[model samples]
Target: MLRIILLAVALCLGPIAGAAQQTVDQPSSTIAVEDSAERDAAIAVRIRNILAELEGYEDVTVAVTSGIVTLRGTTVDQALAERLTGLVARVENVVAIENEVRQTTDVVEQLDPAVERFLDRFRQFVTYLPLALVALTAFVLVVSLGFVIARMKRPWDRLAPNPFIADLYRQVVRLAFVIAGLVVALDILNASALLSTILGAAGIVGLAIGFAVRDTVENFIASIMLSIRQPFRPNDTVEIEGDIGKVIRLTSRATILLSFDGNHIRIPNATVFKSRIVNYSRNDERRFVVDLGVAYDTDLVEAQALALETVRNLPFVLKAPAPSVWIEALGDSAVTLRVAAWIAQRETSHPAARGEAYRLCLAAMNAAGIEMPGPTYTIIGAPASAPQQAASPAPAPRQPAKAPQNQDLEAQDVGVQAEDELDEMISQERQEQADHDLLSSAAPEE
Candidate 1:
């Protein structure tokens, strides 16, 4: 056990002794050593004078022997202590340096330097106060001029198509002028280099905010484009993406619509801009069709002529384009005939006119003994041996309907006029929210 203990102790001491030996005998690579003691004393005095002339090194003491210099004492911080080795090496005939300076623990030593720095900064600020004041005044004046110009509403309102677009123009003008003010102030202060930093920071913040509100930005841009190009006017009946309604107003973020059923719908401007739009109110004339089927054995020529005459005699049908009837297809039980007619859509309700025309035409054909049969099926393979039971009384035959006389069907009040209720609602909405609406009736439509 004693032999093992002795071996471990020897192993640990061996590396330590070797390391110390190598450190102590390391040769200086910088300068040749001097033999004279007087030269060493002179070197120490010169280093002390150099330390005294510089700040943060007052407590540092220097000693020299045989061309070697040793630095001892403390500094306020490690950075200053580490800086001493490079400064002392620049001295003449210094072979090597032992930098023993350390960070000081005394609070007064640290506080004194901070107070001296503050006082020095104060003196420089007092000297340059007049120039700083001039720069500040220039900045304020420039910014105030920008504000003054932005507040004038005439130019922006005239340039923009609507209030929403006008507000955007004013905002852009204000931003541009603010940037100009910053540039002028920075130039006056001789700090134009800082402009790049400020702008770069602003760009990063703006990019992040843009991503955060991407939908809102898209909607705003769409509103600007829509306001410029006036797709539809107030009270125009349109179908957008499948939603059929009358246009109520255009807003910054949304397009408001009043549906035919008197329900309000709000769609985002982005969706509206990208969707396919069908403006029914843009054209005064619209075509409606009524499909009727007659018995396959019936003469197609006579059926077409009868349908055309029935649709043409309707009071709401436009006479210039006239009415048309054609054999559409051979249906399962009859021949389908498509009858189409043009109408003044604004004056006539399309659905009501179509329903009334279908009723009158079918009655006229039935009264003329033209059969219109529904689908029929014949059951086969029934056994005659099936049981027979007493039958219930048969239902009475339905009476054939008669076609109305020309005088009776020629009235204008026969459910063909368009409804005005939804139009009234939309007009009221537009009146109450006129300030926010971007659409104008007098503007040319696209």
Candidate 2:
């Protein structure tokens, strides 16, 4: 009976030992599987987090099974789908990627967010309607006050001598008031922050515009200064920066000149304002110069007296200023004398007076037996007969003395005609300007 018990105990212990071994092996396999599954799960979570961080992958989904990742979701486009696959493949535990992401082509889905945003804005606007209305009313009232002030011409009557400058001042005042009103309205709406943004944007835009229209601004400023100074008036004979002409009109952009040939010339106001201006018509009395060449043998004092007498007797010459002649230079052929006389430009045409002076002086010189010398050339080698001929004297030409006619009456007629024409042009321009002003006043404000 002891032997039977020992065998039975051995069989029971063998079965127990085998069962323990099997249990140990099963646990080892199970642990490995669990570790692999956990690793895969961690990798999938990491991939999802990475994709979430990236843009245009909001609808993407990541799944992992046995270390292989599968991306399945609707992407915005094929490019994003490819990008998602590439991102997943870079994960540490990921063996491969099954990219099943599709690009959605539904128009309604694309427009849904935009429509919702617009609705939200509309709701906000409706909620602020009362405040908006009050701000608008305040803006309108302030602008109306600016308009009323601009229209009151009596306040700027002192500036009437320069209408252009006056108009500019009025515009500046109106703009200042309007901007002040705008600031007040914005403050009332609790949008003072917006004012800073608006002002910054306006400054940037204004800088750009200033660069683009720099020349125009300069011309306009010069025009205002010229108007206030009144350097020259209409129909004045002027020489500006080498351009000689009669002033026709002075517009905001340019100074209009009627050239001696009757062509219209437009010089920019900035250039005109910066140049040296010579106004021939500013004074009624103007001096004219004539250079006369007489024979070297003639009496210099007697020739001067004769020229002075002739100029004084002319109708156009001014007696108070007087006519004078002086010996100017001694040349190889003759003696040069300068004859100067002052005349009333208003009563005489300068060109006509100058021409008459030349003719009468030549006649007087001839009648007085004064000779004008011809050019004498010396020969290095010449015949004896040639030298004798050069030295021989010739008879002086005689001219009849005739009384000089008064030409001032003709010049006065021409001046009166020019004045009439200028007045008509000015009147027509004024009428057109008035019509434009009326039309502008009648138009409704924007």
- Give the Cα lDDT of each candidate: 0.83, 0.74
Candidate 1 off by > 4 Å = 1-42, 64-69, 89-98, 107-134, 377-408, 412-418
Q: Any runs in candidate 2 off by more than 4 Å, and if so which?
A: 1-115, 373-446
Model 2's lDDT to the true fold?
0.74
Q: What is the lDDT of residue 29 in candidate 2?
A: 23
Q: How many residue pairs clash in each candidate at the backbone level?
A: 0, 0
Backbone clash total for model 2 is: 0
Expressed as tens digits, the lDDT of each residue in 338-430 for candidate 2 is: 899998887677776777787778777877878866566654757767644455565465443333443232222213345445445644654
Tens-place lDDT per residue, model 1, 330-441, is 8888889999998887778887888888887887787567888877655574487988767778666544334454423442443432457778778887889889899976
TM-scores, all candidates, are: 0.80, 0.63
